[model samples]
Target: MLKKIGFVGLGTVGKHMAENLAKSDYALTVWDEDAEAAAALGKLGVKVGSSAKETAKGQDLVIVIVPESEQIVFGAEGVLEGIDPGTIFVDMGTHCPETIERMSKEAVKRRAMFLEAPVWGSKEHAANGLLTILAGGDEALLGRCREPFSYFGLNIIHIGKVGDATRMKMIVNMLQAELLVSLSEGLVMGNKMGFTPDKILEVLDSGGVASPLFHSKGRSIARGDFSRNLALKYVHSQLERVLEAAQKFGLELPAAETARKLYAQADADGRGEEDFSAIIKLLRR
Candidate 1:
């Protein structure tokens, strides 16, 4: 039920979310470092702001979807600079928990409410308005923003404090990477056994062991289609964080580590911008 929403960062996920919000009744303004991105959103009836400071000025709510956490909090004229006190700020970027806490404290000091609502799912899900949102901060605040959040996400989960949503988002992304890489390896192994990947998928589809992921990415991976819906490099970064978290807990996560290496190998092969299914490219190579 926000009157005005200012958004920063309109990359793959941010752009579509902003588009959906623009189609709504809320007055929307957006700013991105890329001029082309700003112009693109402008076409959707969104007012393109000149700077991050200008974007946040006098807005009831502000959203930051930049990739790098630094850009969201402390980049040149970051969100903290121009957002008015008492305005609700929601960050949908995947940032470190400590960093999110620090930024949240600063926002609180300025009398603004900060919510970390990092999302799960890729660009395809964003475009489909089916992404799963992991929201953190006050429950009442999340309730107030539910309508705007639902404009672009189907599943909205309110986790814990200001940074818990980011941690949960990383966990989900880590699992997604592991599952995708495992699916890629399984397809490669099936191919080696003289089984066509399509045939394997047919058999797996009818069993309880199969998942939507296997049927979706499985076909693309088998066909070696490494397009850029979900970039392999971003998944690799999530895996790195997962591994570090696991080590901190003294837990053994061998499968996740192996999957991380495959994603890293795929990224190293210059398939960084390709879909997570591109891990199959590394396996087949």
Candidate 2:
């Protein structure tokens, strides 16, 4: 029953999520550093707030989806400054678990609730309201926010308490990075061995290893079209975080480490803003 919503961050995926929320019965107010992005949402009946703090005031719920944790949680005009007591704040960005835990503690001190609810899937999924939400924090707070989540999330999994969702997301991204690298390597090997990319895709699709990710990204890879479904730089950042988390537990992820290098290479080559699938370019070279 959390009706009044304050939404921050209007990036590639965040804008679509805010648009979905606007379609719901809730009253929505949004703020972003990009005036054009905020103005675009204004046409859809979403009120534009001058700052993050201004957006949080009077809101029953505040949702943040920025690229970094500090952008929404820290600063003079941050969400924390304007959030009223009893307001539930959901951060749906992939960030450091330790950072999320620290922010959660701060929210509690202010009598506000904070939930880490990072999502799975790309911009396309956000646009279609089919993203999978991995939630952490109190179950009761999650229950109260379920209605708004339904607008943009097809599946909502409550992983555990605060910080757990971020840990899970890092693990998920670790596997995802490995898979993309494997796909690229396989395609490169196939091309070098006189096999067509389409043939390789067809064979993979006919096997148990086939997945929605492979099918969608595979087609894009075959056509040499890596047009930014998910940015390569962000995927690289996630891989770095995953490795950091693994190192903290005295474990090493060799495959993820390898994939991370390839992504890093892609970013260094000025393809950072391209689709993560663009890592295939490294293999192609």
Candidate 3:
């Protein structure tokens, strides 16, 4: 059991994940780009560190959740540069799969264990300790980390080697974007056809198409509450990556592309910080 754990990145998801780990009695040493974010976690009894190296020093495990792959490995005081030789470093951010592989190889060369462990679900799910985790690394290592992951995740799956979890996370997020796009179009089209969103949701709830994703955000849409939960800017970036990868494989994804365009439009309209369901505003207009 890795006892002293260090965390880098304190975004919406990372904050809650660290809080869960802290609540589980892990001796947490943490750092974040935002000093106030670190202070907030420090108030929770976590040791707030000034830099990633300080966070990593002597910790059995180091976890990173930065926005990009490069930062995960080579940012100012990144996890790779700071983690101890024998410590396990888990990359939980959604990032490029190739980057995951390259970083893992480099970490191994430095005698550190590296694992890709991207999570699925929003900040709410993270706060509730219900996110689903997809992990890729040595199977034995993944098994060793499962108990801690279980404290904050509903399920944890060991997919394959180093880059596999990033790929899996992309696929998962792409499907989520697709569903959001389709549901947004359906709701707007229903409203245009003289049916209230509530009526359409009533039908959807009774139909085979109903799901928690739809029920949760659909209710938000029906209630006209489009505040940020998952931002459109993040979704747009992930869709761009998905498209680039799909193009490399010679696949045409019209629906995904359409969804990508809607996100881009929403970004242009300054709704990038708004929930993904806010894409309906463009359609409804």
Candidate 4:
């Protein structure tokens, strides 16, 4: 029954998700720091808000997706400033569970509902509406957002209460980062053994280790196309968050720690802006 939507953040993934949402029956208002990003959505008949506050005003739901954890959501001019009581605020960006917990408190103070529904998958999955949504909060609240979510999510999983979705997202990102690093090492060893990257991919595709992730990333990495589907810097940051959480729980993740160092080296080498799979370039060296 939530028909009006306020969407903030129109970066690489957000823009496409908003574009898809615009196709639905909901009345959509969008805002972003980037005027050009907002303009593109405006051209699609989606109302463009002059500010985050304006976008959030008079909406059934205010959705935020951005890099920063606190400022972009609860800052002076952020969505919290314009959200009406009873309006739901859903954060779809990946962030640490601690940050999300702080945000939940602020939403409670304002008498507004908060739900953390960080997504899994990357830019292409977002564009195609195949992204999986890991939702955390009241199940009834999640059910209300389900229709709008369907506009951009192929899978919607209810993941416990307010902070659980972010924790799950970090866990998923950790595995994704580790697997990509593992693949990078495999491709590197194959190259050193005088096999082509494509040939290595062919053999991997035929084996027990085969996966859609390996197939997609391996082919793009083979073609030397490191265009950004998921930025390496974000992946590195996620791994860092995962390790930090692991330490808090008195756990050790040897593979993730090593993968973070490799990703860190690539980030330091100025490959942070490239696709996450570009870490293979570091292994090649």
Best by lDDT: 2
Ranking by lDDT: 2, 4, 3, 1
**How much is 242 displaced in model 2, in angstroms?**
1.2
Q: Quick one: how many clashes does candidate 2 have?
A: 0
For each candidate in the order shown, give its overall lDDT on alpha carbons: 0.84, 0.91, 0.86, 0.90
Misplaced by over 4 Å in model 1 are: none
TM-score: the better of candidates 3 and 4: 4
Model 2: colliding residue pairs: none
Quality of model 1 by C-alpha lDDT: 0.84
- List, residue by residue over 139-254, the lDDT tens digit for candidate 4: 99999998888888999999899988888888889999999999999989988899998998898899899998999999998888999999999999989999999999999899
TM-score of each: 0.95, 0.97, 0.96, 0.97
lDDT of 2: 0.91
What would the per-residue lDDT of candidate 1 be over residues 1-285, giving only the tens digit for each residue?
A: 579999998888888889888888999999998999999999988899988878998999999888766654665677788888889988888866777888788888879999889887777788889988898999999999899988899999889877788888777887788778777778889889999989999998999868988888877766667677777788898888888888899999898889888888888889898777888777777
Query: Which lDDT tens digits does candidate 2 get at residues 1-285?
Result: 677999999998999999999998899999999999999999999899999999999999999998885655677889998998999989999988777987798788889989999999988999999999999999988999889999999999999999899999998898888899888889999999999889999999999999888888989988878788789999999999988878889997789899998999989999999999989888887
Clashes by residue pair, model 3: none
Lowest lDDT 10-mer window, candidate 2? 68-77
Q: Which regions in candidate 2 have their CA more than 4 angstroms from the true location?
A: 69-71
Q: In candidate 1, which residue pairs get closer than 3 Å at backbone N, Cα or C atoms, i.e. clash?
A: none
